[model samples]
Target: MYTGMRISEICNLKMVDIDLENRRISVVGKGNIYRRIPLREDVVYMMKEYVEQEREKSKFADSEYLIVTQRSAKMDRTAMLTWFWRLSAELGFRIYPHKFRHTFCTRLIQLGVPILTVSKLVGHSSPQMTARYYVKIGMNEKLHAIHLL
Candidate 1:
């Protein structure tokens, strides 16, 4: 989920699916495709902490997923949305889970990541979808034509 995986794919993730040594998590992305997402250090740390706590509680003894329910079963999109909505309401923020994904792409574009790369990372099937929000910010040399005119 942190890597912008579709809710369905995230729900299907298993602990063994992640290559923790390589810092990569494999995802079943859009169009039934598969891709590997690099794990950020923060994500790695969070996972480590979660695993440690889970082992201590034995609540996840039989589960091999990063997230588990009270019954130690896989988490579904509905559960995710319910939790997200409740938290957002409490925080008084008009936030949706998907908005964070959009923000992730927007920030990458602002940082000048190539459109193709961002598209791949976000699991967009086409660069066109990725370009929808890459509105140019600040100066563009093309705009210098105005001064010349």
Candidate 2:
């Protein structure tokens, strides 16, 4: 979700979905429609390392899935949720899987990114959806606006 992709989209990501040279990932969103999202430099590096070092060394080295279960099969949604639950318990904080997507969108909006751009990046159907949900006005922004007056 750090990529602002839904958990299902992430789980469904395959080796073919990524274009490392171009730093982009193609994913099927809510309506099974394909959308492209740019990957950050760090994310590109991580993907490269994961595909080469970790995935290559795994027993299911030939698996096309981006992320896999211990058996080398694609990880199920339930497994992902269980993993997050265990992680939250270990970290002593609430960790909802969907919240990562929210955080990604919220951070971009908070950083003053254009709503249309943010919506496209996160594969939202329209800018309206992004603005309605993720674009929040914080106190700092309010104070800055007041100061500008």
Q: Which candidate is the best by lDDT?
A: 2
The residue pairs that clash in candidate 1, if any, are none
Candidate closest to the true structure, highest TM-score:
2
Tell me each candidate's TM-score.
0.82, 0.88
Write model 2 residue lDDT over 30-82, tens digit each, in one string: 97667898888998999899888987777877778889777646877888999
Error of 2 at 44 (Å): 1.3
Q: What local lDDT does model 1 show for residue 139?
A: 68
**Candidate 1 TM-score over all chains jointly:** 0.82
| Residue-level lDDT for 31 in candidate 1 | 88
- C-alpha displacement of 43 in model 1, angstroms? 1.2
- Any idea what lDDT model 2 has? 0.86
lDDT by residue (tens digit), candidate 1, 1-149: 45866667777888888877788898877687777889888888787787778644766656877678775567878888888899989999877677777777878877888889888887888888889765455566567766898
* lDDT against the true structure, each candidate: 0.76, 0.86
